[model samples]
Target: MNYYSHNIGDYAQATTHLSLVEDAIYSRLLRRYYAEEEPIADNMTQICRWVGARTEEEKEATAQILTEYFQLHEGYWRNKRADAEIAAYHVKAETAKANGKRGGRPRKEAPFSEASYGGTAGNAGSSENPPETGSQANQEPGNKNQELKETSPSPPTRASGFDASTIDLPDWLDRDEWCSWIADRRARRKPVTQEAARRQLQQLAAYLAEGHQPGAVIANSIAGGYQGLYPPRVQARPGPSASRAQRLADWTDDLRDVLASDRHPREKFMGTIDATH
Candidate 1:
């Protein structure tokens, strides 16, 4: 797999205690694992060298991280989560390839009804001067309007239509939003099919299930022009609130100084007192 999904929260949680160097080594190890699509050999010296863990402390930290997150399988260290993600990636890729070979999803055909048929029939006989030739006889004047209405260009349909029930999407996400997103993707020249959308929906659903907000995720993807869904960017710290509190504290100190100064009350109130006196 050329790429695999990563959960920022999961990664942050797992590496919360790791130092910067240790975290770098751990990230490199994970990349190697996914790129090779297999486990790393259980060789401390080689692993340390490969990950640039030159110091003894760095090597020890790397070993600790691996021991906590990976398991030795057949003399190689393997991460279960990474393996599962890679497997899922392969399955989705194969499904998409197969879908492409069979031609992308068929365009959605408009539904037919007896009422429309009756209207066409009513218009057909009302025309006193019927078309003389066989071709003209087949082409009714109202039929042209009906065909144009039926075949009016719309958003491209997926081979398999999106079914919200198949994936656990949030209640706020409706078919219109889904179709609109797909249309935007198509407009950007992305090869979006129903199957690919379904897979992305599955990923988004998983993120939502993990307690992430649906709106934030959707908005982030749209703004970033991401082809796949991902967790929202970590929120910035509450700097505004802290700054407001600091300003209030400073104002209080200034007020106390004014009241305590030896200047006249009116002068102090007018902010003309010199505290240095």
Candidate 2:
């Protein structure tokens, strides 16, 4: 696996006490681990050299971080989280490879309907209707001057860009919009496989079930050019009651100003007297 998921918060919490050099070493070791898809050899001299821990302090920090986050078994040190993520990546890659062999996703077909054929239900096989000549026969009933319009064929549905055979998508997602989004990603060189699409749908569904508008969520993802949908970052704003309270406070200040103005002599005199005290 060339890449893996990294949670900033979790990393920050775990490496809070480490020095900058130690942190760098830890990050490099993690990259090496994922790149090799296996544990590091349980040789301290080789580990220190690999992580560039030349100094005593650096060496101590590296060993500490490794002991705290990794487990040693059979003369190799392994990170559980990294191992699990690499395993998942392998599974997804294999699934995508198999899907490629099966010739990609199948196109969705529109349901057949009489309206789609461009004729009214009673127009077919009606004995009462008499055959007319020229334009009259071609024209629809009441509008004699207007010729019958041909029903246009429906627009072709877009391809899903993923392997349909490997993924079972939910009906809530708009297939056309989803396909268009995937195509856009591919054009940007951010192609996603069927497994990734399935995961994205799951996340999107969660946001939708929380009362988010599907259109808004999808629009946000498209505008940001993100491969996955995430919850919107909603800033905290004053609510209705808070706004009303602020308005009332402003009104009270205005009233006080008016009362203090010379236009009201008696009130102004009282305000001056209070100020003097």
How high is the CA lDDT of each candidate model? 0.66, 0.66
lDDT of 2 at 238: 42
The residue pairs found clashing in candidate 1 are 105-159
Tens digit per residue, CA lDDT, model 1, 173-276: 56555655666666776756556655776565555546555556666666656666656645334344456555556556545444543233332222234689
Range of the 10 consecutive residues with the lowest summed lDDT in candidate 2: 264-273
**Per-residue lDDT of model 2, residues 163-201, tens digit only:** 433354444556676766677777877777655765666
Candidate 2 clashing pairs, residues 3+ apart or interchain: none
Task: Work out how many backbone clashes candidate 2 has.
Answer: 0
List runs of model 2 lying over 4 Å from the truth.
106-277
For every model shown, the clashing-pair count is 1, 0
Candidate 1 accuracy as TM-score: 0.42
